[model samples]
Target: MNADLSRLANYLNPDKKKLAAKGITSVRSRVANLTELLPGITHEQVCQAVTEAFFAHYGERVDAEVISPDKTPDLPNFAETFARQSSWEWNFGQAPAFSHLLDERFTWGGVELHFDVEKGVITRAQAFTDSLNPAPLEALAERLQGCCTARINYRKRAKRC
Candidate 1:
């Protein structure tokens, strides 16, 4: 989560936005290597080259404008909202209610499972079996409620059964 926030901060940082404002008229790439592009491979050299490239691509000569990060305004609740919206549960847990069926045959009997799913988790479970003992099946159905349908999660939960 910290990594995600850091990435968003870096990309949306004022310094990066200032660089973007300079605008690119064109970008022509030929068969070239990084060594050729930056002989020194230093931060200062890279910044200088990139700054020059922004103006060099254009036919008309224009003075480069200096942008202040302090002057840039921040959006309200953007980071928090973005973090929430990008979460796994927010994206996948909103799935519509559905039902799932699984049938399997063991040495003792054949079992059929019916599950009511909501928001990607099991809300209810019903099990039918041809075996004499139905206690295990009832217990299994009770345990299934509130379990997620994801294969890995289901596998971990199914271990008890």
Candidate 2:
């Protein structure tokens, strides 16, 4: 059965509306009963079917090209390219500012830590506690400033805190 794909895309994820606003077209839809009817279908079969449908629809408008599977494409700057793409600055440094909160209860008292994060670093931190002596918590909040919140850095710094 055919479905209204644009409506289905909006129904599935409202974020696609932003894609449309940015002049990016999205082909978003799902087949519901195909797998139930043919449970033994292989990944190659699905790819072939999708490829055939795409070529048929776009017929003559698209040029087809194929590269041999055995040929290895030359990439001279592979190491540099990989390093840049996989770096934390490339991945999370562009993220918008946000706040994270963590709450814990210790034998002495309960403590809540709030972090204001920007550019993948903890810009500001605050700690609230019911403990009679809050000096340790204050020091921890101070230590968190300017610390990278990436998983590896956070784990190392958190151990010290």
Candidate 3:
């Protein structure tokens, strides 16, 4: 009825050989479950045991920081903000020294901006609008190439379009 916690520990620890040498070989096959163990273990005791085990196995001390839940900063409400913006939807991808894409969709128009991040400039841009005349949007897209997103004046840019 008991789970194989030694195997679990071996799987969790980076150094399996050192873990096996400690008397944890089978993790007491008779204990019947983790629920029973939890009643007797404190969080700090568990942390100290793991830290001691890690130091014993690796011969290096491990430092851990404990932060209270109250000390953490509140996260922004992105979903509420996204819901309020009915006219546009946006998505972006990022990675170091590689091509990144920024796609934005307006209720009546859309724009896709591609960048060569390693070279620090826009490589391509394309726009779509419901208007029969697409030349302006297309030209705007063309003009936007080689510009950096961080420096763009969106309000001024929109006025031109």
Candidate 4:
């Protein structure tokens, strides 16, 4: 979670705000509480007035945002997969990547990842773990074979970036 927060902090800041139609007197402090508060309605959603707040907070501070972690909201599946931390191991693990060179690490309880591509597949890869089964990573690589539109699957995320 800390890693995810820090990653988001690179892109978000909380102290910035654009004033509404009101004059300079209400630049930071808006005229009246600009957000609409409901009566007995606990429905949670940011009023879009606090985009700065979203940028201000990175991880746990997201709890303070109207958006709840329980809901996936606008995050992509792979990103959400990386964000939620089930334990300290998940939160503190190293980020693996294959750039000009294949980069990975062996940490305590790190899951070994294997990649494979076939059927005009240009990439074949494997990893051995002293842990559980390896079918899922294999399947994921297979799913990307037809869609290898980029150099690698992680590269798709870079497109969005």
**Model 2 lDDT at residue 44:** 79
Candidates in descending TM-score order: 2, 1, 3, 4
User: Which digits, one per residue and each the tens of the lDDT, describe model 2 over residues 1-161?
Assistant: 23454466545654668868877665462334455667777777887788889988877435445434344346687556667877999999898999999898999999999999999889999999999998878888888888878753545555676
Stretch of 10 with least lDDT, candidate 1: 24-33
Better of 3 and 4 by lDDT: 3
Model 4 C-alpha lDDT per residue in residues 3-77, reported as the tens digit of each score: 233245445434434333334333223322313344333323333336546656743344442344565456567
lDDT of 1 by residue, 1-161 (tens): 01233244434434545455766221221124455565647666766778778767875657665434333235787566667876769876889999989899999999999999998888999999999997778788888888777633655555677
Candidate 1 residue runs with Cα over 4 Å from true position: 1-86, 155-161
* lDDT, residue 11, model 4: 52
C-alpha lDDT of candidate 3 relative to the true structure: 0.58
Judged by lDDT against the true structure, how good is candidate 4? Answer: 0.41
What is the clash tally of candidate 3? 0
Q: Candidate 3: which stretches are off by over 4 Å?
A: 1-95, 109-111, 129-131
Q: TM-score of the candidate numbered 3? A: 0.32
| Best-fitting candidate, scored by TM-score | 2
Which run of 10 residues does model 4 get worst, by summed lDDT? 27-36
Model 2 TM-score, 2 decimals: 0.50
Ten residues in sequence with the least summed lDDT for candidate 2? 64-73
lDDT string, candidate 3, 5-120, tens digits: 55665445444475477745453432356447566666667668879998899998757654343343344864454445432222222323566666767775666655554344
Residue 31 accuracy (lDDT) in model 3: 35
- The order by descending lDDT is 2, 1, 3, 4
